[model samples]
Target: MVTIETPRSPRNRKSAQREKQAWLFMRASGVVLIVLIFGHLFINLFSGNGIKAIDFAFVAGKWANPLWKIWDTLMLWLALIHGTNGMRTLVNDYTQREGIRKFLNIALWTICIALIILGTLVTTTFDPCPDTSVASALPQFCK
Candidate 1:
């Protein structure tokens, strides 16, 4: 018969500097996330006509202004990156298989990159009233 001992908790071999930097990043990102989340909510859910104010025209109006465009772009990138990083941390902590962990991390980052690119493009270049040299009856505003 053989007896096996359970493995001890993983030890931190990282240097103090590296550990400190990681800690700092987590804290900073967390703080920024709070601000971003709240501000986004306040803007989208409380301002103007509230959620009902969200229309193609409203989006176009927002992008027409540079400030809203910047705000949206920042929010998109920050939220995606922050959420991805947090998920990465969770996966790292809980995942026991190296192969699965690597695959999940790759997938997470890939999706984040793809979404960020697509979202940024959409927000920056969205046109509510598409260019139609001809006339059409859709929304009077679009016409």
Candidate 2:
């Protein structure tokens, strides 16, 4: 008896492209995160008044700036995507069952979506002073 070997389908090629894209994203996001994270730390910890200067008022001031908003937004999105995709890779590697892999991927994406939504809302809709009645408790700049 003779056995025949079948060629890979287009679906396999598409899957390969997705894998390559994921790998490329991992490397690119890693490089970007390093720069953004370090810049964030340096600005917050080593510049000007340094860590001691960090307070509710400081954060409020940073958020007031559109540039910082964009910076933080980019950081949030890139980190979440990078981390989720990393976890997805891990799940694919370690999970042997088809069902388990699918479940985990769905769960990862759900969490990522939740986080992205929550973080974006918090960053964009942040009110420095929600209760204006409590003037003293709020930041000095709030008045």
Best by TM-score: 2
Query: How would you encode candidate 1's per-residue C-alpha lDDT over 1-143 as one tens digit per residue?
Result: 88866744445756556646766877887888788778878877897789987766667666777888888888789888878888987887789999999999999999999999999889877766776663352235666
Worst 10 residues of 1 by lDDT: 132-141
Q: Tens-digit lDDT track for model 2 on 1-143?
A: 98865643435878989988989999999999999999999989888698888987788888889888889999999999999999998997788898999999999999999999999999999999888887776777778
Whose lDDT is greatest here?
Answer: 2
TM-score of every candidate relative to the true structure: 0.76, 0.87
Which pairs clash (backbone N, Cα, C closer than 3 Å) in model 1? none
Residue 56: error of model 2 in Å?
A: 1.5
lDDT of 2 at 65: 90
Residue 51 error for model 2, in Å?
A: 3.0
RMSD (Å) of each candidate, 1 decimal: 5.0, 5.6
